[model samples]
Structure formats: structure tokens, C-alpha cells
Target: MGTITTFQTTRRIVMGAGAIAKLGEEVRRLGGKRVMVVTDPGLAGTGLVDKVEDLLKRERIAFARFSDVEADPSYETAVRASEKVKEFKANVILGLGGGSAQDVAKVSSILATNTGGVSTMFGIDLVPKPGLKLILIPTTAGTGSEVTPIAILSDHHEKLKKGIVSQYLFPSVALLDPELTLGLPPSITVATGMDALIHAVEAYTSVNATPMTDMLAMQAITLVHGSIRTAFANGGDIEARSKMMEGSMLAGMAFANAGVTAVHAFAYPIGAEYHIPHGVANSIMLVPVMEFNMLGNIPKFANLAGMLGENVAGLSAREAALKAVEALRQLSKDLQVPARLSAFGVKDADIPGLAQGVMKVTRLLANNPRLLRLEDAERIYRCVL
Candidate 1:
């Protein structure tokens, strides 16, 4: 018999153009009077934050804002954010902005009820207590951190990114307002949309993928392939933004359960050691990893090619599988995503150290359909150079 699998997501998802209007009502409905909004400096004084504040005030829900989160949030940032949560005596936690803010909120929520530093709960299923009621509002249509049972923090002491995976990390609600992403700049739209694509691709090709997750991943891939360009070209188009947001959510759900593979495994170290954005790192490694993993599951790759809109008619599975890779390259080129690690200041001499770092993320590597040896990891990094 096959091994049984489990999938999870937030209890409630409120999605649409005007979903932010329910922020306060959702908190109140969940019996939370004091809410803590965790976000990053990039969003601190933006009208978006002010708009949320206004909504909370209109509903008479008292709230506190902590805007100290940074990209690839550090353990210290999470610790300090949790202190704010405790100081406010907040019964609810709201994560606003991108993945970093959401990750901080998820970790701080755990620290609110669990008795320890965030570092103590680093591994899988280590969190022992239920956290405060949590609501996540994603300003960007990427990361899907709002819906996942995972939180990633940069461990400065260790000089690598670490993840906390636990059921307790799942939020009580996810409020996805496509309107919030209207003003997103083109570069972010490209990077984040590619992030969503990677999530779906990795999940679909994961060794742990199930029939359920495959369906979700395929739908996500199709949506992203069809809508990312439109969204990138015109961020204000609600239709395009809505499709990207929905696709990103589905991809998040798929990966959160099926797990991501080597692309993410290799990307983590680049982000941690070099301060590259997670999405950009993933984008840089995407093609190389896919090429390396192609032979491991040719049929699946062929299917992916079809889903990505590559014409596979009259072609062998192996030939068609290669098209998926070319399609990805074309998409990256169209979006002007940097294709070389050198663009990010990484050198050929850095390959060995990065390969070693990739080994440390065995949790993710073990799920790759193609087993990645140390030498192969080095080669992947070099190929992107």
C-alpha cells in the first residue's frame, strides 16, 4: 500500500478586491479584541498600512503595529516582534506585507504561547502549543506564507536560513486582497510570480506529491503561466492580479503539503549567505535544477510542459520534457530576470561552499525526485554562473 499523506490550510480564506475591509470584523468575529500587526519597514508608513489602521479603527478593534521585520527575517527580529505581541497583550496576530512579515508573525505567534526563543522550535513539528488567533494579509501575491504551516527565519548565528514547520504555525485566517498588489512594481511582480511558479513546479515534481497535490499544482502552473505576464505588464489590472493571487495561493497549498524539492534547497543558501531575495535565488536556480531533474521523471516533465503551454504534439516524452525548460528560460528572459549567479556577485569559487550549504537542507533535498549528490549540487551552481 502507498503511504498516506496529509494536507492543511488556514480555517478561513477571505479573498477579493475589497477583502481588507473585513480585517477588524474578522478579528472581532474570532473574539480577538487586541490585534498585533506584524510588518516590515517597507510598509510602515505606506498608505496601505494606514488603510488597514483605518479599517481597524472603524470597527473599533484596538491594535498595535510592529514594523521591524526585514527580508528573510532574522531570529532576533522574530524574538523582538514577539515581545511586541506580548506587550500589547494581543489576543490576535496579523501578518502584513510579504513573506518576511508573514514569517515573523507566524514565529512570533508561536513564541506568544510556547515558552522559548524561536530558535528552540526550528525543526519539523517541534512547536508544542497552539498559538494566538492569527490572521494573515498578504500585500504581495507571492510566498503564500499566509497559508502555509511553515515559517523561515534567517539564523544569523548559523549563517543560513532555517525553517519551522508545525501545524501550530497555520494561521486562523488568510485575507487575500488583490487590490493591495495593484501598485506592485514590475520587478517584484516578475520575481514573485516566478516564485509562485517555482512552488507549483517543485510540488508537482516532489517525490511526496500525491494525486490531490498534483491537481492543485497543475492548476496553479496553468494560472501563473497565463496571467503572470499580464500582471507584470500592468500591475493595476485587477483581473491579472486576481489570477496571480489565486494561483500563488494554490501553489502554496500544494507545496505546503507535497513539499518543495532541490530548487528551494539550493536557493536557501544563496539567500542566507549572500542576502539574495528568496524569489530571485529560486529564479536563478530554477532552470538548472529542472534540467538536472529532467531525466528522473520524464513523463511528469512532459506534463509540465503541456501545462506551461508548450506544444508537445508529436514529440517523445523526453523531447517534450525539454520544452518545459525552454519555456521557463523564455519566461525568465521576457521578465528580465537575471540568469547568472554572477549577476548576484557569486563566483565560481563560491560553488563548493554553496554545495555544502545545500547538503545541510537535507529535509528538502530528500524530497527531490532526483537525488542530488554533492558534486551535482556544485555543478548546478556553476551552470548558472
Candidate 2:
């Protein structure tokens, strides 16, 4: 048996169709009076921001809004948002929208309490103190930023995506309300759903996988497999949206504790360099990374294949693993996710640079079941390219 280590999740999660309504109560429970709501301009116009603001107002909670967060949020954007948090002297932060907003809010919380640039916190356990009272509400069924302790922010000057990993980064409360995801565009739905799948697949096959993480990852895989198509086809499908939310949350919890693997490590540089959406980058790299990692953990892949509804019964573990990769490839094709990095304008010469960047993502690379050398990372990039 693998050595069992203690696992910890700092966030208290409340999940349901209308969990967003509980935001005021949760904030008050944490003794937060002044709050900042961080989100994107698009969501701010959708009136979802107003709905949340109303909740706080009814509870007599004082708040401010920072709606400049963009997709694939940058370090500068986070720093700018942190300025608002500091100016308002906000005691609590409410992240409302997709992963971008949630990530920015988490970073702002840290910057509000800590005295340093955001870049200083990149890497493992670098933040010295716990972040402020943070409440995250994910409007998209992807990225799982609500429950995760890791946040990815782009560094435009460096042309790379940097991550901050620390137990202190987890939110004080994660409120997942599936109703908030009802109107997502089909394209966004497909990309984010696939991102959730990548998280489950990587966490399940991670070198650090524990029994607890395994259970959550496997269940998340099943939910994504069964509901992704329905959610993509009809964005208003409440039932499908609910399942995706649950799956994404579970995957986030599992990966946050067990760690992500090569897929995420490889995808980061792509997102940072090419301006690819985080979910789309993960979608493009998912199948290729799975193909590379299959040999390292055939049994896990076989189980994943079975979870995705592939007919792997009575097959050898190796064959089942191969089937799983093929199944994921087909799913991506059906969802209209680009099959290759070349499709996204990645050049042959960029492979070497990307490989170097992938090597720097040691926090994620260390969790991969298969050891990935620079050459292996380059090969994987070429395959996807």
C-alpha cells in the first residue's frame, strides 16, 4: 500500500442549485462586513452582479465592485484589482464569475494582507499568512477555482503562465450555484467541461493520488462523461449543468489535494504564450498528454476508460488504457475542440521554448505518474503541434 498522508482542504463548500443566495449568510458567518466583488465586465452587465449585490445590500453588508477581470487574467490585472481591495479596505472578497474572476479575487485577498508583488508568491507554499475571508462563486462549470488552492495568472512580460500554490489560498467558502451557469454559450460550455475532465484524468493518474482523491476523481470522471454532451448541446439544461458543476467541483478538490500532472504543466505555456483560453488549452493538450501518460499507469487509465463508458471489459490493462485515450479524442472532436496545437497557430520553432517553460512547472511536473524530461515534453508538444 502507498503511504497515506494527511490531506487538508481549507474551504468550506456549499453546493446546490441556488447556493448563491446564501452568500450574505456565509459572509456574515465569517464576520465580514465590508466586501469586494471581483468579476468580469461581461458578467457585470448580465445583472448577475446586481443579484449578488442585492443579497449583500439586503443583509446591510457594505461592498464595492471591481469588474475589470479578463479571461486568462494577467498579473497586472490582479495587481490592479488588489489596489481596489486596498483602497476600499475590504475585509472580505466575493469572486463572482468563472475561473478568471475567482483567481483574481484569491490573489487580491493575498495582496490585501501581504506586502509584495503577485510574482513573489509564485510556486509552492510561498505565502506566509492565510488570505483574507474569501468567498468564491463559480458561474461556469469549469476550472474549479472555487475549491482549489492554486491560481494561474499570466505574466505578459515573461510570456509564461505562473502559478501560486499554498493551502492558504483556498477560499473561506465555495458557493456553487448551478443556476448561475444556465446561460453559458455552447463554446464556453464545451471548453470548460473538457477542462474539468482533464483535471479528473490527471488527478486520477497522479503519482500522489490517495484513496480519498481517487474516489472523487473517479466520480467526477463519470459525471463529465455522462453529461458533457447534453450540457454542450443545450446550455439551458439545468440537470446537465448541475452535474457539470458537481463534477468540476469534485475534480478541483481532488487535484488541489493530489496535484495535477503533465497536461496542465504543458498547457500553461501554451496559454501564456499564445493567449489561448485556459480551458481551450487544456482541451487541446488533454488527449495527447493522456496518450503519453497511459503507459505509466495502465490500470488507472483502464478504470478511466470504463468510467467514460468505453467497452473495456475483459481487455488487458494496456489495451484499455489505449481505448481511454481514443475515447477522449473522439469526445473532443465531437465537442469541436481543436485537435492539435498547430490548429491554434503554434509554430514548430515554438516547441523548444514551450518545452523549457514546461520544465519550469515543477510543482505540476512532480505530480505526474510518468517522469517527464525536457525531451519527453518536447515530444509531447510536437505530437500535439
Candidate 3:
């Protein structure tokens, strides 16, 4: 037996086309009278927020919109958002859009109730109480923020991305509408899909992997591997979009329990300092991190090769592991995601500091299959720089 483990995710997840239609009803079911709708500025302008407003209006739910959420949002942004929740006197916190918006919503939910600095809530299971009733609607088929009981915020002062891991961070309800993902640009689609894929990849290879998490992760990988290209090329395909969303959610559940490994740890520093998009940052670090990680668990890496649909017939586990890395490289190339840190303007001089940042993400690094040192981190950063 591995070890005693407990798995948790959002208790109620509503998935299908028009899942967003349940937004108002869900809020009402949660006994919410006044609602605070949180989303990013870009999504605010996209008429999706307008649809959300219309739903609440139809239900006669009193609501306010806070659309200032940004990509890799700062802790201050979350503080500001919580203040909005307070100002609105909202009984329900409705998080809309993708990861950033959802993460901000989670933070806002907790910060409203916790009555403490957001920084204090960072790290594992530190929040002492649940926040407002929360509902999450994911417009993009990535982040899995709706399901995962973790919210990440950027700490600009430290130039690092920090995560808040608390059961209270999980939304009371999650609404996944595949149609909401149709309007995503190809770039956004590809990046988010890769993020979803990497979540499963890392979870499958994590030292913390449990049997249930492994089941979730393997299925998530297969779903994403089959659906990502179709979704990327034809963003309007509902079937593809649905599968992508499902894959992302499954990946979220997998990583939520088993935890993601070094790829996320590596991505955070670049993402925080360089302002690389989260998915793109993960993509940039994926190959190098996996190449380094494969040595620790060649059998898992070999499994990844088969799951990613690489023909691993008649190959040794080590050889199949290399093929897994090759497959990720080819997929990144095909999807046109950044494959190197240099593309994000990360310089040779920045490697050491960035590696140092990676070390601070000990929560994630603890799950890494391979034990990594500071020098190893620096070398990994240099690999793509």
C-alpha cells in the first residue's frame, strides 16, 4: 500500500452545455440573496459577463460586478476583490471566467470571512473558516479552479506565485459550460489546454500519486491528448470543448489530491516575474523538467508515453520515457506554445534567482518524483534560457 490519503473536490459540479444557465438558481439554492460577481476585465467586455448579469436579473438576484481581476492576479487584487464582496454585502461569491478570475474569487471569498491579511492564508490548510457561499463558472476549459481547493495569487513584493490550499477554497458549486469556451482565441485555447494536460502529466508522475488520483490523472491525460488538437483547431466544436473541459476538471481533481510536481514549481517563478501566461510558462518548462524527472520514476514516465499516444512499442522504459518528452515537445510545437524561457525574455542572468523562487514552492516540489537541488533548478532554468 502507498500511504493513507484523502481526496476532495467541489462537492457539486454541474457539467454540460448551458451549465451557466444554472448560475442564478445555484446561488439561490445556496441561500444567497446578494451576489458578488467576480471576473477579469477582458471577460467583462466579452458579453459573457453580460449573460451572467442577465441570468441573475431574471432570477431577481441583487448582484454587483467586480471585473478588475487580472492574469496571475496579485494578492492585493484579491484583497481588493474581497473588499468589493464586503461592500456589496453579497451572501454569494460568483467567480466567472478562467483561472485568474476563479482564483481571485476563491481568495475574495476567504479574505472576506477570515479577517486577516491574505499573505497569512498562503500555504497549506491555513484558513480557519469557510467564507461566503461560492459558485464558480469556468468560461475557459482550463485551470480547473472550480474543482480544486487551491487558489494561487502573485506576491509581487516577493516576485513569486503563492498558493492558498484550504478546503474552504473549494466552491460550493461549479458550473462548466462548454459553449462558454467556444469564443476563446486559439492562443488561449492552446495554452489553457496545455496547462490542463500538464496538470495530469505532473499528477501522474508525482511521488504523492494514489490509486484514485492515478485513475483520474490517466483518464485526464487521454482525454486531453485526444481533444486538445481538435479544440485548438476548431474552437467552436462543442464536443471537443466538452471533452477538454471534462479533461481539465479530471486533471484538477487528480492534482488536487495527488498534487502537481516540479513543472508547476518551475512555472511559478517565471510566471510571477516574467509575466508569462501560466499555461505558457508551464509549457516552456515542461520538457526540461520532465527530462530531469524521468530518471526518478521511469515506469511512470513510460506510462505517460503511452497515455500521450506516443508509440512506445518494443522500447525500454528509459527509452519510452524519452519518447514522452519528445511527444510533449512535438505537441508544444504543433500548438505553437513557447518552448523556451528565452521566449518570455528570461535571461541567463535570471536563472539563479528564478531557481531560488522554485525552491520556495516547496509545497509543489515536495511532490516532485525526483529530489531536486538548487543547482538542479538553476541548471533546468538554464536549459531553456
Provide TM-scores for the models.
0.99, 0.97, 0.98
**Which 10 consecutive residues of model 3 have the lowest summed lDDT?**
337-346
lDDT tens readout by residue for model 2, 65-163: 999999889989999999999899899999999999999999999988888778789988899787789999999988998888888899888888888
Cα RMSD to the true fold for all candidates:
0.9, 1.4, 1.0
lDDT of model 1, residue 376: 97
* After superposition, candidate 3 runs with Cα above 4 Å error: none
lDDT of 3 at 118: 88
Residues 38-129, candidate 1, lDDT per residue (tens digit)? 98888876778878988888888899999999888899999998899999999999899999999999999999999967768999999989
Q: Residue 235, candidate 2: how far off, in angstroms?
A: 1.3
The segments of candidate 2 whose C-alpha lies over 4 angstroms from its true place after superposition are none
lDDT of each: 0.91, 0.90, 0.92
lDDT tens digits by residue: candidate 3, 215-312: 99999999998999999998888999999999999999999999999999999999999899999899889999999999999999998999988999
